[model samples]
Target: MSVLIEVVTDVAADPGVVFDLELDVDMHTASLRGSGERATTGSGRRRLQLGDEVTFHARHLGLPWRMTSRVTAYDRPHRFVDEQTRGPFRSLHHEHLFAALPGGTRMTDRMSVTAPAGPLGAVVAHLVLAPYLRRLLRRRAAHVKQVAESAGGRR
Candidate 1:
């Protein structure tokens, strides 16, 4: 069984600014309000391209989880996709889309994930992971909104 969830936020900034932030993996540490410090995977490697691997280390509920993902697809200033290489999930595919709107930009996140166990895992993920990821994205979106709009539209 597979579970998918999508979240959207209207950021008060252009897609260019927000898209840049998404590509900057290390900047994520500062994008969200709180998640502790973050370390870059390739440290000096700052290229966002297909097959680029990146790892994010963080804790949720005091339980540490390392998220390892690779850039699956990229469409400059428009859409980019990443998939989990190794993590709690059996598989995870995340697609990030950005659309330029009238006053700002509309960012959408779509995730397709397969939990470890089978039907049982799907149930647990729907009841837990789904909601959790939704909330996490919401919070992260809020931060991105602030960061993007703070500079009178830049970051």
Candidate 2:
């Protein structure tokens, strides 16, 4: 079974600013500092764009993990999609959406993940992975919002 998780965040910044920050590798690393997550390969310090691939290494649940994802879709200041090409999960896909509001922007993250081990995987995906991923995404969104609203983010 595939587990789907969605998180929405409102930021006091333009959609373009939020979108760029979302694709910033350095910002991503800063957001998941507790997880020790870092992009080890691909894209380097630059923002991700369509057809780009990035490999992130992190420690989660007391175990070291690595995942490589490719940016499959990009529309700039609007929507983008990244799919895991190699990872622990059988499949992983993430879509990020940005919409302009009166005062700022609304950012939405939608992720779908399928685990590897049949029924056992299905159970784990729904119970453990879903909640964990939701929390992580929320944290990331909060970080983005904070940065995007700051004066430095306007640059």
Candidate 3:
């Protein structure tokens, strides 16, 4: 089974700033420090661009995990998409979108992931992966919001 997760965050910063931060590998690693996430390949400390691929190593639920994703779509300051090329999941797709709001930017994250295994994995996807991913995304979003808001808004 596939699990879907949606998260929205409002930040007192320009959409472009938030969008750029979202693609910053250093910022991502910093935000996910608790998980010991690091970029093993591709734009390690750089900002990802079109066709850029990144492989991430992290630990979750006390287990080590690695995932490789490529930027499949890029529109800048608007939306971008990344799909898993290799990972523990059967499939994974993530989209990041930013829109200018009244006084800030509205960032939305959409993630769809399917676990490995058969029917048993479906249960785990629904019971474990879904909630775990949700929390991870929320933490990442909060970190991005703080960075964007503190970094100052730039068009």
Model-by-model lDDT, in order?
0.80, 0.91, 0.91
Q: For residues 1-155, could you state the per-residue lDDT of candidate 1 as single tens digits?
A: 88889999998888888887777765566664365636456435764667788877777656777888888899878999999988889999999999989888899989998899888999998999899888877777777788788857632
Candidate 1 off by > 4 Å: 32-37
Sorting all predicted structures by lDDT, with the top scorer first, yields 3, 2, 1
TM-score ranking of the models:
3, 2, 1
Can you write out model 2's per-residue Cα lDDT over 89-133, one digit (the tens) per residue?
999999999998888999999999999999999999999999999
After TM-score superposition, the amount by which residue 29's alpha carbon in candidate 1 deviates from its true location, in angstroms, is 2.1
The TM-score of predicted model 1 comes to 0.89
For all predicted structures, in order, the TM-scores are 0.89, 0.95, 0.96
List candidate 2 stretches off by more than 4 Å: 152-155
Poorest stretch of ten by lDDT in candidate 1: 35-44
Compose the digit string of candidate 3's lDDT tens values, residues 1-155. Answer: 79999999999999989999999888889989999998954655489998899999999999999999999999998999999999999999999999999878999999999999989999999999999999999999999998888777744
Worst 10 residues of 3 by lDDT: 38-47
TM-score of 2: 0.95
- Candidate 1 vs 2: which has more TM-score: 2
